[model samples]
Target: MVSIEMIVAARARLRGHARRTPLLSSPFLDEIAGRRLFIKAECLQHTGSFKFRGGWSAVSALEPEVRARGVIAFSSGNHAQGVALAARLHGVPSVIIMPDDAPKLKISNTRALGAEVVLYDRAKEDRDAIGARLSEERRLTLIKPFDEPQVIAGQGTTGLEIAEQAEEEGVSSAEVLAPCGGGGLTSGIALALEARTPGFRVRPCEPEGFDDTTRSLASGRIERNATLSGSICDAIITPQPGNITFPILKRLAGPGIVVTDEEALRAMALAFTRLKIVVEPGGAVALAAALFHGEQLQEDAAIVVTSGGNVDDEMFARALALRG
Candidate 1:
């Protein structure tokens, strides 16, 4: 479990690096939900996602010798860019292993950031096996996408900032929501909120077809390892919650709420049209939950962390059409 001290340390370590992303009020969502809504726009973060918080935190926490050895990670998109950018900041080399079906924009962005990219087949080949072999052969330190304590601690800083921003804005006990893929961001937010405010409720927003966190919370075990289907939310396409993130989420999160692909696409379009922000399908899941799952939220003041904004042009048009 991550402690408040760890979050504080992470904040200090990432002080100059990570953006103090804004918490913008959404009157549109507020009118729809009949409650105030604040968005912590991590999509505006460096590398265009909140993943940089954990990525930089993990890399910065490493010992000098480990940094000297460099790092390796497996990710489909946002985390890949995070690791690549973080490694570059620390003057360390990084190797990223991504699924062959990973987004082309993400692959190109990772390469642009000076990281070596290796593609593997997620269906036919095991990415973990390939990563392990590479780690052993190259003597590189493995930096997992979401399963490490330092990574969780780093992610917790976002929650810490949110709580502080809420307090500054004179709102107490707001409902905090985040997109859950491998559970890193959700678990970290819950831990930080529980420690800092103790009155706030942190919830996970998941894609309907890929609601592993929701199903796992309902079943009392992390068992949904099936591949996601029929969704444009590729950034959050995970088979299951991360082993390290599941237990923490179970202990700290309120509940997992699932939103459909249509809802997510609508939310993405709404964000882009109204807020003038470009949010990807996965990043808009929290907003979808707010719009579609309002009954579960009741009259609570809500805050959704818009996680990323990387989307292809064709997909963006499709999402906009879904809104219509």
Candidate 2:
């Protein structure tokens, strides 16, 4: 488990390295939700997602010799680019094993960031095993997307930022909705809030039919999704919660929420119309839950953590064309 102290340290280590993405305000969203609805615009972050914090956190923690040997990671998109960029910044070579079916933009961006890209068939090959083999063969340090303590602590930096930024905006209490994938961002934010903003609660939001984090919290154990490839919210469809992240989310997060694919599209459109921001489907789930499931949350005010905005042109057009 990662502590608040580690998160604080991560912020120090990431100084000037990661962007301090802003908390955006939308009067339209406030009117619709009937509360002060602030958006934590993490999509504006480096690599277009908050995953860079964790990648930088993990890679920067390595000993000099180990760092020289480099790092490897497996991801559908967001984390792939994050690790690639983070390793590049540290002068460390990175190898990314990504699903061949992952978004073209994500794969291209990862390679452009200077990481070696390995493609695997999601339905036939085990990405985890492939990553492990390459890591062992190359003496590369494996940076697990969310389970690593350093990664969690680095991601917790987002929560820390939200707490401070909210206080600056005179928000004494608020519920934070974050997209869930292996519970990394959600669990990390939950811990940060639990320590700093005691009145604020972090809630994990997921796409319907892929709500493993919610089910795991309910069942008091890890739960795996039935399938991984169906959702348009491709960036978040982790098979199960991380062993390290699940316990933290189970302990710190408020009850989780799930929204449908349509709802996510609606949120994406709304983000563009109201927030003037672009958000991918997986990243839009948090705002979707907050928009469509406001009654379920106890708080009058909330922060929707928009996690990413890396969609292809066709998908972006499809999201915008979606009707209520």
Candidate 3:
């Protein structure tokens, strides 16, 4: 479904549009990790997550006439904001279907970006079904959160940055840790690292109970999460890995990693104090694994993506409290 060429093409499309988010390192974090730690702080990206890259890629790939027809998408939050913002930028109309339980900040931000917001009960209703109905009724093009070739290629650009940035920093080989929802980010990074920076690895990181990608990798097939409504990492509570994304991840990624909400919160706290940045729970998972599950990672410098920073005030406070 994707390749390094696609990632390169997507990166060209994203230049001057997407921020080439810089990699950050900290002495404190290094002490905690006992290895060199570089954070690709995509939390600083537009729309507060890497989703913006894929969203823009999908929107930008649309034919001019088709772009005028507008687009629809389903996201718990990050992708919603991304598509909304991308549509606004391209002067395309957008409608986003989001769960009622998604973070209020994310919902509000999405709407503020000018997309119509549709709410659904995550437990009682199927977001995709609702989105499909809307798409059919409105004739809006549907841009999925992940699972699309353009989306995966767009997300892969982050890995391109990691490889180039690491080399600039004089690092030879590294294992990458990225937050996993449906494996878009992980798989995309895997493809890029495999091509541009041989020997570099991508590992999927997820919340404990919702670690479907982890289990799926173990069994060599896709598996569903028993419950998705729980994790504090709301941004990445996808039920299973995407069909297109799974194969790439299965081939290039290392063993999956899991961290608890507590660990995620603590990692968020650490990011704030050590990195001087705010990170949401889902965004902190990779860093959480780096900080708390180090034993499981490859014996090399770790490059972790603190994927986003769109948390609600209350939750951000709770994450900060863990610091004390």
TM, every model: 0.97, 0.98, 0.99
Q: What are the clashing pairs of model 2? A: none
lDDT of 1 by residue, 100-206 (tens): 88779999999999999999887789988999999999899998888888899988999999999999989887789899899888888888898888888888998
lDDT of 2 by residue, 79-132 (tens): 999999999998889999999999999999999999999999999988878987
What is the Å distance of residue 136 in model 3 from its true position?
A: 1.3
What's the lDDT for all of these models?
Answer: 0.88, 0.91, 0.92
Preferred candidate (TM-score higher): 1 or 3: 3
Q: What number of clashing residue pairs does each candidate have, in the order they appear?
A: 0, 0, 0
